[model samples]
Target: MNLHVIDTGFFKLDGGAMFGVVPKSLWNKRHPADENNMCTWAMRCLLIEDGDKLVLIDTGMGDKQSEKFFSFYYLQDTITLEQSLAKKGFHPDDITDVVLTHLHFDHCGGAVSLNASKGNFYPTFKNATYWSNSHHWEWAMYPNAREKASFLKDNFECLESSGQLKHLDVSDWIGNGPFPWMNILFVNGHTDKQMIPIIKYKEKQIVFTADLLPSIHHIPVAWVMAYDTRPLITLEERQRFLPEAVSNEYYLFLEHDAHHEMCTLKDSEKGVVLDKTLSLDEL
Candidate 1:
């Protein structure tokens, strides 16, 4: 099995929103903000090459949105999904599975794209079976008022329209075996049924952190994001995930962290903290 970090460039979002309830003085030290108070974050995705299955996790924000939308997020240095995959010696057509952590715009937008001529929406990975949970699929389709804007129809529709949308129920196992190498963990604080993929690689367990732990700075229990629907539930979720991470020495693959990519957790006086910072290559 091979894992590669797919860089889809960066975008800017309000720092305050990213770090919910945490004071600027605290989070600012970790993720410094720009003059406009927006912080630049990497849309880092992961490509898992296991045998003939090339799985891409969480496509970054695609370039299909209007200029007005891009202006809000300050999308820049976008390395398209196609370009990033080609760099790994694979084309979009070569991808066999796309495991989406969630259906947020930034995470799943790149799953679909405008045609070459910008005429209509299409699946970026034409041959991959796009994987999304049944719960998340319903949540995105009938989004609540708070998250409605984030659930863009173009992003979700393209997957099904391409005849490759495979809704993974709560019990779908990869390769259909008693002991699955790839296991899915579900968390609800960030959004309903956000699936985190836990991969057994090199006799080690590496978890794709997704939004549950956006960056190393978010390892602390109280550093939960403001975007979480239920902040208290988020606290509980973190408590559950942190100890397992520390005990198992799990490598966290961050999605929105600008600098640090992968990190391990350790118990600190204050609480759980980052043990060491490294990239995926180090693993």
Candidate 2:
């Protein structure tokens, strides 16, 4: 199996929102913020080349939203998803599967795109089957007031309209997914049922640490996003998942951490801390 990092570039979000409850003095050391109190984040996706299945995991926020909508996030250092794929010698047409970690605008927005001919939105990956669970889909469709801003209908509604959307069994949410070389670990703290993909490659496991651990700085159980629906649940989920990550030495593929690509965990005296940061090629 082959793996590649798909860079959709960076955007700015309020640093306070990214690191909830944690003081700026603490998190600022790890992730510095600008005068606007915003920190830059990467929308790094992953590409899996396993046999005939060329799977793209989590497309970043696409450029379909209006300028007014984008002004809020302050997008920068951008490249289209197509350009990222092409750099890796592929294209959107080459993708056969798309696993949306969840339908938050940042994670799944690129899953759909504007169809200029029809003057409507459609699946960006025209040839790929978009994966999202039923529970999460329902949650995104009828998002709570707190999360409604993050769940844009234009980002994903067209998957169902195009008949390419599929949900994994709810039973498969915890462990052992239908995918031959991957497992699913669902954590509800971030949203209803955010799916974190655990992939096996070259006898090692790579955990796509969606929002469960957005960045290495989020290793501490207390350092969760303010945007989470249930911060307490996020703490519980992290507490449960970190030890195993240390024991198994899972390589964490961070989606939002602009600086670090992959990292391992170690049980430190204080808690589970980052062991080492390495490029995917190092694996």
Candidate 3:
């Protein structure tokens, strides 16, 4: 099995919001803000090539949003989804499975695109089966007051509408897959039922750290995001996942870290600190 890091591009968000309860004095140093007080973040995605199946995890914030809508996030950098795929000798239509971690605009927005000629939304991966959980699917469609704006209807609706959506509930997640290396674990707190894929390749386990660990800076458990609906639950979730990662020597593949691609954890007096940072090629 081969894993590829697909970088869609970078965007900016308030550093304060990204690191909940953590003082700006600390986080600002980690990710320095621009004059607008927005810190830049990478919308990194992963491509898993196991035998005949090509699976992509999380599409970055797509380019379909209006100019006014995108101005808020300040989506910069030109590394587009199509360009990234082409670099790896694949195209959007070549993806067999698209595992959505959650339906947030940044996570699943690139799953669909606007066809200029048709004037209708369509699945970005024409031949792929887009995977998302039933609970999360419902949560996104009928979004609550807190997360309504982030869960864009155009992103989630296009998948099912195009007959490319597949719901994977709690009962459906078995570690072993049709492809021997891939497995998924569902966690809540960030959103309802976010799916994090754990890939077992040879002796190493590499987990796709979704929002649970957006960047290496988020290794400190208390450095949870303000966006989390249940911050306390997020604390509990991290306590469980981090220790297990340390014990088993798991390589964490961060989605939003622009500087570091992957990291291994080590227990410190202050809990888990990043042991080492390296690219996927190093593994």
Candidate 4:
């Protein structure tokens, strides 16, 4: 199996929100903010070429949103998702599966695009099945007040409307999770039933650390995101997941960090600290 890094683009978000309770005195040193107090973050996705399945992990925020809507995020893209996939010798229709970690705009927005021919939104990969868990699907369908803004209907409403969306069953998640080489980790701290994909690549296990562990800086269990609905649950999730990551020697594939692509964590005297930073090619 081969894995490809799909970088759709970068955008900005308030550093305070991204770092949660971590003070500017500390996080500021790691991520400098602009005059607007927004830190740039990458909307990095992943592509998996496993036998006949050409699977895409996440789609960066799509371009269908209104200009006013995008101005808030300061989105910038050097290459389109189509171009990124073309560089890897595949097209949108070539994709067989799309694994959505959650239904947030940045994470799953690109799943749908405005069809120029139809004057409406439609699934981007017409041939692929869009993957999202049942619980998350419902949560996004009816988002809470705190998360409603992040769960934009235009980003994903087309998937199910077009009959291409598939809700992966998590009830039997512990039963090897519907994939032979990939396992799903259900985390609820960030959002309801967020599915983190742990794929067996090369000789090591690669964990697609979505929002649960957005960047290497988030390795410190206490550095949870303020966007999390339940901050305490996030702390609990990190406390349990970090040690297991170290023991299993899993490589974390970061999705939002613009500076770092992937990183390995080691159990230091103070707890899990980044051991090494590298790109997917190093794997």
With a 3 Å backbone cut-off (N, CA, C), the pairs that clash in candidate 2 are none
Per-residue C-alpha lDDT of model 2 across residues 108-173, encoded as one tens digit per residue: 878888977889887877899988899999999999999999999999887998999999956864
Error of 3 at 111 (Å): 0.4
lDDT of each: 0.87, 0.91, 0.90, 0.91
The worst-scoring run of ten residues by lDDT in candidate 4 lies at 170-179
**After superposition, which runs of candidate 4 have C-alpha atoms over 4 Å from their true positions?**
176-178
TM-score of 3: 0.97
Count of clashes, each model: 1, 0, 0, 0
Off by over 4 Å in 1: 116-118, 173-179
Measured against the true structure, the TM-scores of the candidates, in listed sequence, are 0.95, 0.97, 0.97, 0.97
**Model 3 clashing residue pairs (backbone):** none
- Model 3 agreement with the true structure over 40-73: per-residue lDDT tens digits: 8899999999877999999999899899999999
In model 3, which regions exceed 4 Å deviation? 175-178
How big is the positional error of residue 274 in model 4, measured in Å on the Cα after superposition? 0.9
Indicate the residue-level lDDT of 160 in model 2: 93
How far out, in Å, is residue 256 in model 3? 0.4
lDDT of 2 at 200: 90
Error of 3 at 27 (Å): 1.2
